[model samples]
Target: MFVLSVLLLIAAVVLFLVGRGKERSASGWKLGAALSAVAGLLAGLFACVHVVSAYEVGVPVAFGKVGSPLTSGVHFKSPFTDVTSFSTRPVDLNLNDDDVVEVRSSQGGVLYADVTIKWAVVPAKAVGLYRLAGSEEAVEERLVLPDSREIIRNVFAKHTSEEGYASAREQIGSEIADLVKERLAPRGIDVTFVNLRNVRPSKKLQEQIDKKIQQEQATERATEASRTATAEAERKRIEAEGVARANKIIERSLSDKVLYNQCLEAYKEAAKAHPVYAVPCGTDSNGTPVIVDGSKSG
Candidate 1:
């Protein structure tokens, strides 16, 4: 606008000087001044017409041919040309995952799921994406989100409820992220996060899963009890065998002659301490008795 105004002002001054030098009428000068003023006004209006914005770069085209995109500062272009503003900043897209749909599992169970994915267009490739995919909505509708849903369903379908909740959740999340990146990276959208927020199975399936878990736990308990009983029985059997072996050793160490000799020795020791009692020799109740007929010994 400034350049065009200056050009018009110079033209008016030139016209005035020439008309005055030739002694032309003042009306000619007025006419020339009016034309210059109008030209300047129109030029200024044309220059100020297009948009110059922040966080935006204009893709300028001249006569239907692709021109250089305007950088992050002030830019001026022809009034008749087209300039498309492309945002250079990151865009945050929140895609709600409620699709109002139910999918059946292989086990005759119906699974209902609500999940969200965070994604955005890579700002650098926005123009190329627009050219190829037409619009961000089009890109999402055609390419990015469908792939996301497919990846999510594929990952989720492989897991049981327990697996989906506990061990396989991280695996599913990682797989979804990988799958989305694989599909979206080529289309210039970066998938930052893919999360499985909520997954619900049919009520009947949930009950079945619960009952199955309960039965498994009961089986485990029964096996544990049987192991304990078997161990106790083995311990008692070992103890009984030990006692029987000890009794056999005691029996082997005893004899009738040894018992008789032990008794005789004890009786003799007692009789020597008490001599007044005449314990008969041959038919004595005591096994050892004092010998009163020692003089008749032949």
Candidate 2:
């Protein structure tokens, strides 16, 4: 469009110059020039306009040198310059089975991790980013992905296979994001978040881990049962001791007269209920009487 407008302006100039030498055709040539000039101006106006979306930032480059960043909305630049847009919103880069990362665990086991990283180009440094990283695609290829792989390896290396598989998986992701951000922030990439979707150890290691977990659970149950049984036994022993102590107190408090009176009262109460078939044995030196069965006397 800019080229066409420039051509139209040149044609208008030629027509106006040619009209100077003509007499009868001069008015027609002037009118044509005026219309062409208006059309050319409109075309040039349209050519220099560029609209940056709300979620993007545009960097203008003229003659291979970067210019001021163009924020969202309409921007005007020389027709010869170029504007490149980079997304300012968070972008997700998934590292899954198609591009899985392999790392070694603290236990020296091989592990596979599927991760995703959310990031964006810092708007303030977008021009610098373009100069250094070229474009958004280039930034991801040259910086985000490689850094993500390296960070994952470094973070997972600090954890055992079981930790990577389950226990510290979230921690590993957070550490990776932090480390990657620290490393890439200076390079104009802002790391927002990282997700470790799946991290798997070898099948053999997984089976061993499952068995170990089951064994630990079983041991915990057994320990709890033993503790309960020991508590019940202690309780019974205490009850027996209390009963024996009460019996001893009763025996020590009773004298010959008290024993005689208690035996008489017991005999009266028993006689009222049924026939008495026991003989009162004489008191011992302890002054506690004993009963002798009449049926066994023979």
Number of the top-ranking candidate, with lDDT as the measure: 2
lDDT of 1 by residue, 186-279 (tens): 7777777766665666688788889989999999999999999999999999999999999999899878567666656765776677543344
- lDDT: worst 10-residue window of model 1: 275-284
CA lDDT of each prediction against the hidden true structure = 0.68, 0.86
TM-score of every candidate relative to the true structure:
0.61, 0.64
Identify the runs in model 1 with alpha carbons over 4 angstroms from their true place.
1-71, 77-115, 158-161, 197-202, 257-298
Model 2 lDDT at residue 172: 82
Pairs in clash, predicted candidate 1: none
Query: What is the TM-score of candidate 2?
Result: 0.64
Model 2 weakest lDDT span, ten residues long: 288-297
